[model samples]
Every structure is written in C-alpha cells, then in structure tokens.
Target: MDAVLSRLKGLTADELREEIIKANLKCGPITATTRAIFERKLARTLVENAGLTEPDSSGGNSAWLDSSGSVVPPCATSATQDSVTGEDGDFGYGMGLNPPEEEALSGTVCPCNVENSQSETQTPSKTAQGSPTFFYGVCPLWEDVLARNERAHVYTDKKEALQAVKMMKGARFKAFSNREDAEKFAKGIFFSVKFPKLDHPSMMEADTINREKANSFKSPRTQDLTAKLRKAVEKGDEMSFTELVWSNPRYLIGSGDNPTVVQEGCRYNVMHVAAKENQPGIVQILLDTLENPDFMRLMYPDDQESMLQKRIRYIVDLYLNTPDKAGFETPLHFACKFGCPEVVNILCSHPDIDKNCKNKYNQKPSEVICERMKEKGQFQEVKQKINEYLEDRLYIPLLRATDNSSQPVIGAPWSPEPMENLSPRLPRSPKDPVMAVRAFAGPLSPSKADEFRRVWKTPPRERADHFHNILKSDPDRGAERVGRDLAHELGHPWAEYWDFLDSFVDLQSSEGLKVLEEYLSKKDFRDRAHEEAGENETSNRFKTPSPVRLYDCLQKRGIFFSS
Candidate 1:
C-alpha cells in the first residue's frame, strides 16, 4: 500500500490530473478529503496500468474488479509471498473481486494496466454474459462499437429490452450478466444519460404485454378455421359464413390473415371477390367482421384504397380514388361494366362514390357502358337502366347536325376538358358566355331535351348565336326556305315581297294555307311582321326567329315541308 502511494506521488501533477480526467473522476479544490479521494483514485489507476493482475485462463473470462479496487492474476494464489511477483513471485494483495476459476495462469490479460512500457499486451478480454454483450474494446457478435458510455441498459425481460431500445437513444446497447457487473463497468466513466436499470418488474410487464397480445385475437386464425371460412365464401355457403364468423370474431380482419384464401378465382381479396361476384350479403358480412375498416386493402399492385371508399363512400377525389388492375377500373366501374345493376345502384347512391371517376383508359363507367352498347344491342336497355340509376349524374354524348332530321345525332363523347379543341370561330376565352353555352349544349342528348330546356337559359345574344349556328348547319333547309318564301306576304309595297308571298301561296295546299293563316295571324307575329315591313326586315332576317319558329310550328302541326 505504501509503495502504491509512493508510485502515485511520484507522478507529475499534470500526469495525475490527466489520469483524473481519463477516469472521469471528480476533482474538487485540493483539500484533505478531496486529496485523499484523488490518492485513492490514482492508486487504483496505477495498479490497473501496472499489469499486476492475473491473466484470464477460462475459455471466456471477464474482468473481475474487486471492492477494494485491486486486480489479481487468474492463477491460484496462496498465503505465500511468491504469488505477488514483486520483482519475483511473492505474495501481494489481490483485488479479491472474484474467486479464481482455474488452477494455473492461462496468460490472458486480467485487468487494464498503466505504465505502457512495463505492461504486456494481450488479446482484449471477452465476457461470458451471453451475446449482445461487450468487452473493453471488442463486441464479437454485435455491431462495431462506434461510441460507448459508462451507463448501459440492463433488462431482465423482453418488455424492458424493447422499451430500453426505444428510450436509449444510441444505435446499439450492451447486455450485462448481473447488476454488479453493470455497476463496475459503469464506474468512473462518462455516459450521456441514465437508463432505467429495472429487474423482475420488466419480466412481469413482458408477460402482461404478451397476454394482452394473445387476448386481442378472440380466436387465432389457424389454418383449419381460415381454410374453412375461405371455402365457405368461395362456395357462397351462407351457413359456413355465419358459423365461421361466430367462431372467430376477427376472422375477416384483413387479407393477411390467410394469404391462400382464393375467392372467385382472381388474386383479389375476399371483399373484392364478393363485390365482383355480386355477393352483397357476403360482402356485408365480411365488412361487419373487420375491427379497423378504414385500413387500406390492396387491389392492384399500384393502387391502394380504404374499405369505406371501396364499399360506402360514393365520391372520392382524384388522388384517393384507386383503380383496380383489370382495366384500372374501380369496383363501381366493374359493377357497371359487368352489368351488375344492383351493385351499381348501391355504389351510385353512395354519397362518396366518384361517379365521374375515369378508368385506366380515362373512360368513365358510363362511357364503358356506352362503348359496350355499340357492340351489344342488348346493352341499350342496360345503358338506359344505368342512366336511370345515375339520373342527374349521367353523362350525355354530344350531338351534331346530321342529314336525317328524325334520327338523333350522336357526335363525339363529352370529356372533362370541353375546350380541348375549340372551333377557330370560337374565342379562346373559356369564360365567354357564348362558349360556355355552346360547350354545355354540345354534350346534351336528344333524350335530355327536357333537361336542356330547363337548364339552357342562355343570355339573349348567346341564344341568338346558338340558334343561328343550329339553323345554318341544317343540311335539309327546304322547310326553312318555305318559311322564308313567305316574306312576300307582309303586304308591303316592294315587288320582291309580292313575288315571294305569291310563290309561297302557289306552293301551299288548302290545308297548308289554313295552317299558314292561323300561324301568321298570331297577334305577336302580325305586329312584328308589320313593324318589320316598315323597316326592310329582309336585311335583318338572320336575327328573326321566323325560321326556327316556323320549323317548330311545322313539326308541331305535323307538316312535312321537305321530302
């Protein structure tokens, strides 16, 4: 003890201070108490640096630090001076930390040493504290020790291990066999923070957590039960559906419960199979069985959608709308395309259903039906039924004037962007009142005439252009000419006026003449005609409704002016 003190005293103050800083020991103002503390701390460091401790002989040996702060050789020692090796094998005080495990020295380094010139180097010591343990500088199975601290997380159970993993902010941690080992390793070292050093409670917490996990599933989705349930759904066995559901409340929680349950032959999950096959009852039962229905289910590799969006929400915005793999169609699109009117009706009526949602080809469900209608005459009724189901939400195909007046004109289908191709005559301004009216009118079907009539309240100027364009594009304009030829009958003084009316009168039969007299005799028409005659109405003939008005009158009276 005196020699150890003398050796420590011989160290320069700077060396002593360096040792104090290295071991992370507290250094207060030099006083009797603090000076004694420094001497003791320095003595321990010197003993460690001197390589006086026994070499490790066990296949896996660890540092055996003692309460008295001394190191001992791994070789057995007796009450003889020869054991200490003081310039010879002589007895010296040992750390007395751990009982010597073996009979002879195995020549392994026992403890860290000071005085690098006198100390012999050996392979770093390894520990027996199971895997994920660390040595002074070696971590054989764990990650490379990038950074370390004196404080280490110690856990008795997995619950504590996991919790420590979260609370401990380092990338990795070291395990210790006992609290004493942990305390010794943490002694006189710097650590960023204190970790929870817990015991048996951690085991209790782990057991409790495991029990909770087990209880979450009322019945485990075992192979037999899941297989039976899937078979029932595929076979449309209502009895099996009920039985399986009653047996395991969480059976339909997710598709991940059973990966092999094939429904309706496609790779889709059971919900999709039920929806595709028009099994509404099965679909409802499956939906009711889920705990968290809002979690997204896989449809296509690229698409993901919530169960509510799939079954209930009729309308979703573009981003949330996911299309299935087959044609990138949604369930509603599939229902309508496959002629599942019952499913279509349910999905259509859902407030969250996006009726106008387009498929992979950028075609809406209505467009899909219409396209099918062109190939299958039977689909005409289906189209009508779907339209009836969709009512105000239905899309109308655009119309253009055709040679045959009685036959409805079906032009190119309407799209979201109506101004994709504007007629050169049409102004580029999308907000132009005339253009909006034209675009709105472009998509109306002959069947939607009533809807058009109710909604097509264009401003008078735009309305006039709408009429002029319609009349000007009429291929069979003989009826319009017949009405125009009546200009001569204004009872005006012009020669051209008399000639025109005489020609029109010559062409009329007695019934036609009577119909013409009744139409021209209307008080509004007569008054307008008198005013027009006084002001040369022929030049302003383009604005006159006489052409369209007469056309309407002829059609109403069942008069055929053209062959």
Candidate 2:
C-alpha cells in the first residue's frame, strides 16, 4: 500500500494518467448522446464531493483555502467528515438496532449478489487454514512457497498447531469483520492466514460499490453480454472489448427493460474487462453508448479510484496541485508532484475538465505539480505560466513525510502559519509548519540515521521514535501500550508486536535515559533534602532500570527495528 502511494506521488501528470489508464479502470463505449443522462447525480457528486471552488485563472490560494469554504487546519473537504471515519451511522458497533426499524426495511434485499453467500460456504471445502496461500501479508515471493509449503505455522507460530478442518457444520463467514478479527484477535500468530469465504451481503455491497446495474430487467446470457461489451468503451477499455464481447456476440444486454444496457450481471461486464485492460479507446466507445444520465454518475471514488471521470480528474489535478498536499498520497495523488510536465499537458487538455479539481485526498490539480517544481531545479518560468493561467499563486500543504511513515494519522495541529506550498528540501522537512502528533506508537527508523533525521515525522517511524521517548519517561506505561497499537497498525501481532516492546525496553536500559533522568533528579532531590534536612526522601527516587528485554528469538527483521 505504501509503495503504491509512493509511486503515485512520484508520477508526472501524464504518467499518472497513463498509470490510471494502465490500471484499466474505465470501460464501455463513450457516446456523444450520453449527455442526455445529465441527471444531477454525477454532477452532484462531483460538485458536492469535488471542490466547488472555481479554478482561479490567476493562481492564488484556491477559493478552497481563503474563501468562505476554508475552515481551520484540517481543511473541511468536499467529502463529509464521517466519510473519513468509515463509520457513517449505527453507533456502538455490535449494539442492537430498533427491532421495529429492522422490520420496516425487511424484504428489501437484492438477489443479484447471491454468489458471495455461496462463496462463503465454499471456503472450508478445499484449502486448509495452514496452507501458505492462506497466510495473510506473507511477502509475494513467499506466496508460492506458502501455497506449496505445509509448515508455515510452525516457524511463525509454534505454539498453536495449524489445524485443518474438513468441514464445519455451519460456516458463516464474515469476510471483513472476521478477517480483521482473525488478523487482530487471533492467537497473534504470524503466517496466520485465514481465507474466509465471501458472504451474500458483502456481494450486495460490492454490487453497489462497483456500480453494477442490478435492476429487475433480465436478458439472455447471449444478448446480455453484447451490451455490456459496448458499455466498456467509454469507460476506457480498448484491447479487451473484442475479446470479451466477441466471445459471446449472441448474449443480449441484461434486462430488456433496459434495452441499451447488456443483460449480464453487475460488476464484471465488458466495462470491467476493458477497465482491467486499460483500454481507454474502448472506454471512450462504451461511454458513447450509455449516453444516458448515468455515465457521469459512474465515478467510483472510494474503490480504487475507478471510473473515467475520476481517472481524468485525478490525473489532471496531480499535475496541477502538488507539493501542497505533502506527497501525502497514492498514485492518483501525484498529478501535482513536481517535474512531470508530459503528464500535466495530457490531463489539462481534456474536455469537461475542472482545472481546480481536488482528488479523494482533498488536493487540487495544480497543487500536484506546483509544489514538485519547487523541489527540484527552479521552475520559475513555468510557475509564472501557472500563476497567469490559474490567476493566483497557490499555497498548498506538503505531506509531512514520504518514507514508510503512515499517512492519514490524526496528528494535532501545528502552530499557526500557512504551509506555503513548496517542495520540501532533501532532509525533506516541510517549510509549512504542521502540528506534530505527540506520543504515537509504531516502528522507529534507525536512530541517528540520515533518513531518521528527516523521516521522524513519518508515521510508525515517527510514532516509533515517540514510543522510545515515552519509554524513557515511563517504561511501564509506554511498553504496555506500544504493543497493541503497533499490532493494529503494522498488521503484526504476537512475536512482532512483542518484539518492539522488548527492544524499546532494552534500548531504554542500555542507553539508560531512564536511569540518567532518575539519577539527575535523585541527585538534585538529595541536595535539596540535605539543605532542607527535613523533607521526606524524594518520593522513592524514580525507580531505576526497568525489567524488559529482547524476548523474541523468533521475530522478523521488521519487529527488531532498533533503527
């Protein structure tokens, strides 16, 4: 995930678009008539979710910054705050809902997503839990070994034998929740891979998420596949159109009620195929056919940045608004990174383009490139052109750090000062001050290393540093909490999480910061006491060396992060 983000940050505007194109996200033929579907939904989502700030022809801080829309530091974005938390409504998770309310919405389920219900049932049928492929987060190189090897659980988690269940009487698999639990709550076992079967409800969610049309209309498999193929063109599929659609020309477009659309089931039609293949030309074609109001509405922001409009907006903005949103991002976020001219042109020239568009990350198109240019050799002349075109010199915020540090971490606000959008210099510290998060729990970069000096603000790494400092102040409190937090964020548990705790203790003891602090304070207290000759001995001179050591003989390199 971090690598994906880094690459996206590294790409030029054009390259980012190519990356989007290569991601094969768009599908279906684009049509001239599709404008008829100009229902407010697509526009609404864009206008509502995307920045309404008009593009400044003169390039100053976008209306988003200084205008009425701007709020304190975190910048109120187009997407609602709840969207960030991933929990919209229904409080106290696992809490019961009103029985009457549940009954009111009964019988409303859609059936198109039936496959997942059955898929979940099929999990225990084949592979055993101990299988290598079953191990979550195993390095890719180890996938084949994990698949073929039978002893993954032994080295990783020696205590609990990897059990193989032929079948459970009733296996009700809840992929997300169960997966999270297994990863978080399971016996903290590494190589603890549990592939739960898909569930019916999850499939339904995917249908809605992927934008698969699941109306009552039905079409024969033959005719259905054809329309699906046609829809793929505008969505951006090219090479894939012929292969998928031609394979079954006889299939009718799904439901006859919707003659224009293919009858095939949702999510995996020719549009998907084209998207998978990055067929931009084909996407153009499909978009042409679905000339209905739904075309623009198809932007899939949350799921992998799917949809042609999103891809277009993402690519354009990265080249334009960069360095402002600290390369705090994924590939889609790079449209604004410095040094990518080719990409910027490709994105800017597109029709229906919103010059001030911000991506899911809440950065504008110009923010992408402008900040980047500030990093490398001077882009003064180009910056001037940008200023003239946008009508303002933009001041975007740079992401705090770019290393293995975690992003999206809720850090407290830095002192008041506009983070002038500028490229951070090598020891990549941002000129724009940001509120530094205090007391985070995660891995620290190597102490005193060059990267450490600069990347300290980066998450997990920075969090790791905070952990050590806290340990010095209070080992017991710090060590206890560090384990759980690292486990959740790093996706490690047991050996790895424990190892971090152990190492921090050792470092504290060896460096003796705790001891040094205790000694200094005690010495000072004793001197004061001798002078006063009365006050009770300084409350039991701060306890000395803590009792913690490197316990894991069985941990990986990441867990041992002494650096």
Best by TM-score: 1
Off by over 4 Å in 2: 1-166, 169-294, 298-387, 390-563
The regions of model 1 sitting more than 4 angstroms off are 1-193, 198-212, 215-239, 249-251, 254-260, 291-330, 347-367, 370-563
Q: What are the per-model C-alpha RMSD values against the true structure?
A: 25.8, 33.6
Worst 10 residues of 2 by lDDT: 56-65
Which lDDT values do the candidates have, in the order given?
0.42, 0.33
Please, what are the lDDT tens digits per residue for candidate 2 over residues 148-245? 23322111111111111111211111112223343332222433464333455877688677764434323345443455555544354545554553
Model 1: per-residue Cα lDDT over 216-269, one tens digit each = 335434565447766676567877887765554445433333322333333344
Best by lDDT: 1
Scored against the true structure, residue 293 in model 2 reaches a CA lDDT of 28
Positional deviation of residue 315's Cα in model 2 after best superposition, in angstroms: 6.2
Q: Count of backbone clashes for each model?
A: 22, 106
Model 1 — TM-score against the truth? 0.28
